[model samples]
Target: MRIFRKITTPSNYHHHQLRSYVSTCRAVVLPSFGGADKLQLRSDVPVPPLKPNHVLVRTRAVSVNPLDTRMRSGYGRSIFEPLLPLILGRDVSGEVAAVGESVRSVIVGQEVFGALHPTAVRGTYTDYAILSDDEVTPKPTSLSHVEASAIPFAALTAWRALKSTARISEGQRILIVGGGGAVGFAAIQIAVAAGCNVATTCGSQSVDRILAVGAEQAVDYVAEDVELAIKGKFDAVLDTIGVPETERMGINFLKRGGHYMTLQGEAASLTDRFGLAIGLPAATTFLLKRQIQYRYSHGIEYSWTFMRADIEGLIEIRKLCEAGKMKIPVDKTFPITQVKEAHEAKDNKLIPGKVVLELD
Candidate 1:
């Protein structure tokens, strides 16, 4: 790999300018598609040159997401296989080490936290990770790097579903199919912040946490009939568990002209199985058909939502975090050297909540 602007010592980060920056840094690379053992922590991974709108973050903490584990197991092989040796992380919290020439919104030496797109190749699991300008914003002073790292990816996902896709307005009723998980929990809070009455389904253990975060109703899915427990129809339903049965139930719970969105879209799976050429169009057709069918039969909108980098949403999420209103509890933390162990825990479900990787 080509290297440039090499520095032998850590440059002063208290200033707002980066005259020189490190060209190589520590990163966890997935050299091949497989289990956690395939993850290699190398100290000399090359850092790509920043684009005009890019910001280089000196990584402090990154979270292990479900997509990272799935990607390790060859989940997005069609798109990622050829791009082997990919860094596998989405959420990041750290200081701005450098900025591209055209950047102005955020300056060097400022603390920031944000998440990358799910399909990004150059991920955040590095000593220095590249994120687009809008993909990151000022970190909330109320949260640490680890705590800030946990919120963006999960919260942005819920934001995309509730705010972007559903366009939920105040005083509306929202139903979240699975509220125990990070995305579901964040959805509950986002909906409540928007003045929507929130109802959710989860295991009994998560009931308290769900309610603590402003959910009006929490039904234990294992012990109760969801339809009977959730009394009224909803303006929108965000189904984190996209199983056919849950999809049907969520659809039924929505009022006419309401929206139903799911996190598990078949776009990636179809493309992985059928190859991109055939799979891309196939997935589009399938999604269109489902949307049409649901719209015609139930008079509602159906969509597949994914986490995206939204500056406005990210800023609002930061504000919520500043006010102690949004957060995802970190279950366990591992040093960057223990990335393999982190992935293993996530794969075996040993750590049910968020898992983070810290870099010194």
Candidate 2:
């Protein structure tokens, strides 16, 4: 007995429906930088809109880095201050959910992993993330998402420091300072894979692990002086620990005409405590003067490096993982909800290897 009316749908209804599908997702946000306690889990965080050169990904796992903890505590405040309420993370392993029109290399549903540049403001501590196509590569079949997630940032830093900066060559002798941490561990493997004779310094407990990872010699930094315990000069020195004294000792370990590289900025000493205004020029001049002096006195090349995401370098890492030439050592895995605990663990040095956060 009811009268029927003609049914019609709005022309833009489909578009609205499509938008609803990706409107929002859960994410760990930093409302303001201070401590791990500042990270808040929010379900209504908007998904990053796809840009012509970006790909949207459904994050499966992410790893925490020292940078994450430092960023939370307001480190590099001058550089990251404007990006407050930011998502803090770098390494990501996930499945592509959608791609920008211009993304041709990766298709929807493909597994991928990469290190997000910290300055980009877009981070991996979320249900979805936007990644530039060139920064990511297909994840190796041999690695799980959790394992792959533990790689990129640390491994890329190691690769760049050893391969690009130091130009480590086959049969060359190299010294890696601070060999127990994630970046140090990866450097050990990458250097060995390149056929270099590797020597590293680690805590007494980590000596065996470092040697097991292919280091020809592992010095116990806690128990002995690195400059005295290790004999002979190296073709190159890669210093992951960036203390001024360490940098000086690293130079001493380098052979004439050899390269000395550090992952931390040469100006880190000034920059960490002072703003770039003062630190930038001072660091530049300090390094330049040291380079000139070292060239004349030791004929050594000194370079300071900051890690950047590189697609080709990532591909090399993937190939190494696939070939069993590289391995990611995971110390522990926590659910995304336990992010605060994860950060605390890293801050307290509770675990060795990389700490990972599994999204699923």
Candidate 3:
């Protein structure tokens, strides 16, 4: 008679299975911050093991933001220069390939669209992107991957300013400066969805779209004097331009105790200039001075807002997209192999709006 032997399965069996499926994937890496040519396409970038709360997305599409191009051209050198060879993208629309042991919100093969936080190091400019469960949500069935990818980062930024920072409510008046851009247009729609009356400044070409989205007033910044044209005080003002001129107008338009937010926070820029040791403290002190000055003199709150990952906000945005109430039209798209060209278009302002990269 022959001896028989049996072996029990290993305790870490699940992780073993996942790693086998995602040992490596394709990605676009930026070894150094420079022009569009600095971005490189790599075939076998290593995929690290997923943490228990994270999910692995097999990316199909990713939209380019101004941040992506800025980072490529050395925007956050203080933080990013040390961590070179980073994959540079934030917005992603794709299907889940694998989930961590504790992930329950989504299962493998589920279609999802979401964005990473602005400071995330490992981005979505790759075949596989790792995101926490809260950062990914079910994709809106009404939109394609390319179209869906265009919405998240911009919409989330708008949501942060209006809904989270400003606390805008129904029947209140909101002013959005530079409504022709993605974040500005999203703000207009978001405030409208919240049942607030909205007024915005945009170019003549964007007037119809702005009005169609339910903005009560559309003042062309180029053709009209915005201050003279727009009537009455607003409960909140979101200044996308963030220039001295727009900033002054935004603060002046607000009601007492109303909030005024600008997207151009100086935290990162200061850090890039002075390095993290001294720059971070300087940025915080500067922000405090402005906040106090506005509170005392204008009887309003002033803030520098940035995009943050919020699950509730992402789910609500999906509902808006599904209902055809929120959208960001894509100006153009390029395959992942043509990422350089896509980035070049953004830098050159060849396309007026969003640019997306597609992967096969």
Candidate 4:
């Protein structure tokens, strides 16, 4: 004789139900920073509780970056604390394991890839990672998980530097220093895809690969003088290496008000103007000369890049891949246990392309 009351839904009932869901996932943890050998690979680290707009992913693969090595050795620790025994690894490709209550863009089991936050880098290197909905993008169907893993950090950085910072367009002459590296290779393709005239520098052996990637010319940094090979003004320069004096030489290559951007230094300046910060020698040069019209400043333009894992962006990159407009070169792959060796390979520049750690 039990009577069932008319079921009425409460507006907030779903919120409680969602919280119960994220309480159950595991991740790997890093005990300290030293060598990759210091990574503990724990399986009991708690999965982050999904924020209202976050999604939890079961990681499939991750790509290593040199920055990871620096972070592991405690180089940038002052700027970022490793919530210790933290997890490490930045680029991730995975399937949707779960979603927070407010997330609407993806469903469980959808494949995706993106850069994990510096703190979350660890979790991705493990079995699961929870990401803000905005930080994860749909994994391109055309690429394998390993291929997708390699695209996030390098590709996004190249995109922001060339397309966003430099604003390069068709017919613009651009120079990409360190063009044989991962980011440089991506830059060449992105610039060429926009119909720009591209030149890059690498070892002599890498010239053919660079040319095949659509660079109009590839200069061997060891055998040729990069500054002399081009012999004219460039609309933009994407300097990836941190050579101290290259910036000075790069200044000579820029047309009036031309943009110069770099991964490792402040914008290059030609004049000896004043009122600039103390750290940037190039800025000091511009200040000293007071080169009013010809001095252009850039480098603080890539803020949104840190949060870039947009599905639209990756989809666009995939189109380039499908059309043979870009190439994905995976130099090597390591098992999850060989994480330390992978970092050494990257740090020593032993690998030709992205080094990925395959977990699945």
Candidate 5:
């Protein structure tokens, strides 16, 4: 926000004698358009500068997500252009490199992590990244940087989907399809912590891991049909996989007036009423109606959740981690130079847990 000295120079020595030097770092760049394996290696891109309400982070680790793969393949060309040879990543855990004049709360050299909207700022694939002060939270001391980097995107999406849309209540029966995935696993943990009974669908290999994360019952999706195996009506259903048929199957499983939340697909909107709940009733009527509907017929309510990166939300996740209420599932980490492999692993769901990029 404030600049003491601003000059363009070929090297730090040309401008000052004692400026902190952290150049010669490696970063993954998408040179033009290509597949994940082709993410070019660029070693000289300057670490971006800090802005007011922004802090520069010395990235210790950055995680791979589905979006990273898309970005690497030029799938986001419309939104991420004039391309600028962008770096692709979402989750970041690292120490603060520098702070802007107006920045507060986070100080230099403190460890922190969050989901960085790289298209807006710059991606976390680089060794250092400039972050909005509002998008980061102090890292829990109990978590390694790799562990912390794994949670931001998946954990936050899970939290918002359950807390904001489902309003999970005590004794509520919730069904989470695709509970083996990162976001789904996180939802299971948060739901159990909320005093709700959870049932999730995962492959046989992942069933134990899903249960370990707190699901009351793990459905072997490959072996059994979720709708047929789980007979009791649910208060809420989280369809994370969002297959058209999957959504259709889960829709009728909800108790009348119950809510359906999805991370993908637009097939069903939450605004529609089903069964005896025939109107857009007031809050009280809807709650009462849902309670009443549970007594007789099933209801279908749906939502497509869009996630945001918020500091307070990340702080809450940090607290949960410290209390042992949240789990960070990271299966593999690749060096910054191997970013292409990291993206591929995430895209193919080859890793059981989150994938990360380790930086120097």
Candidate 6:
């Protein structure tokens, strides 16, 4: 069901600004990795200069993800420490303000949305941001900037897990864990649209919502044992909640030769928990060992998914959204200045879908 049908251009759409005029922009910056208090609103941040094959976008809205919270808390301090005072957002929807010398896929004044690669120094939590042309596409005509901003990261994760990793085919049976969350919500729709029999597990409050998104069955994981509730076998199990027990249950739900995928992978290791020096390597080895062990025991493939930005995949998602086959579920919208409150809301599980930040 398409909740939003009337497609319109972003309200802030404007003509191109000359690249020669460099200016400062406002952004939410993480000065140091810690808690929500570390997320500071700074107005003097300078927007990056236009580079070849890139486009400068006047940010309209940005979506908050678990990754943003993790990054703010220094979850990957070992890798991201050198990039302190970083902007922490990925999904963005805005109007192109200027284009680089060689950019061709998009033009100034075009409304676009994309998930910025996580490695980028500048992220979407700003008044202006630059993105490589190949990483973005025209915003779906069926959604507004606020709604479009909520989509890219979660949708791309679902797309990669189902399309790239699972290679889901028509009539296949797929079980998606954590169907109440954004990624799981998107996975249900993408799988259902692909002609698969989709079953999902969520809270009792989320059952109706998950089913409304075309899930054939919605099991309340809080009330019942998921492994016992889902009957028969699934062709693939996509687990958005990365936990060892859940992963084991997912493997049990899968049929012989089926695939099981999780989002966390080895990042959630005991070594990391104990603050050991071998945390990273130990976690990687643990994941590898599990993958081999599962393959031999159950004749099922096991893999972890770390979602990446892919233009082709985003384009397919755009089509699905425009055609009313998929919908971006936004739970709440907050001004960029209220980023701390937004993060707290998401961390506290106060929203069913995405918590977005609207930029001026």
TM-score of each: 0.95, 0.90, 0.94, 0.80, 0.82, 0.90
Candidate 5 lDDT, 223-290, residue by residue in tens: 98766787788888888888878777677777877877777632112122221133223333544564
Give the poorly placed runs of model 3, Cα more than 4 Å off: 1-20
Taken over the whole model, the C-alpha lDDT of each candidate is: 0.91, 0.83, 0.91, 0.68, 0.74, 0.84
Model 4 misplaced regions, further than 4 Å = 1-28, 117-123, 266-312
Report the number of the highest-TM-score candidate.
1
Clashing pairs in 2: none
Of the two candidates 3 and 6, the one with more favorable TM-score, higher being better, is: 3
- Of candidates 4 and 2, the better by lDDT: 2
TM-score of candidate 6 versus the correct structure, residues matched by position = 0.90
lDDT of 4 by residue, 1-360 (tens): 121122222355343332223333344455677766776655456655556677777788888876567667765453334356666777788898777667777776789887765444445677677777877778777788888888777777787777766788899999888887777888899999999999887888679988987898898878887777877878887878846576666666777657766676323221112212443565445434534323434222211122245555555666776677766578899987777788778777788677888886
How far out, in Å, is residue 58 in model 1?
0.6
Model 1 vs. true fold: TM: 0.95
Winner on TM-score (2 vs 4): 2
Candidate 6, pairs of clashing residues: none
Tens-digit lDDT track for model 3 on 1-360? 111122222466444343324677789999998999999999878888778789889899999999899988988888888889889999999999877777778877889999999888899999989999989999999999999999999999999999999888999999999898999999999999999999999999899999999999999988999989999999999999899999999999998999999999889999999999999899999999999999999999999999999999999999999998999988889999999999988989898888999998
Residues 152-208, model 6: lDDT tens digits: 889999999999998999999999999988889889999998999999999897898
TM-score of 4: 0.80
| Residue 344, candidate 3: C-alpha displacement in angstroms | 0.9
Worst 10 residues of 5 by lDDT: 267-276
Give the poorly placed runs of model 6, Cα more than 4 Å off: 1-21, 268-279
The residue-by-residue lDDT of candidate 1 on 1-360, one tens digit each, is 234484332243334333467788889998899989999989899887777789999999999888889998999899999998799999999999888766777887899999999989989999999999999999999999999999899999999999998999999999999898989988998898999999999998899999998999999999998889999899999999999999999999989999999999999999998999999999999999999999999999999999999999999999998887898889999999999999999999898889999999
Error of 6 at 190 (Å): 0.9
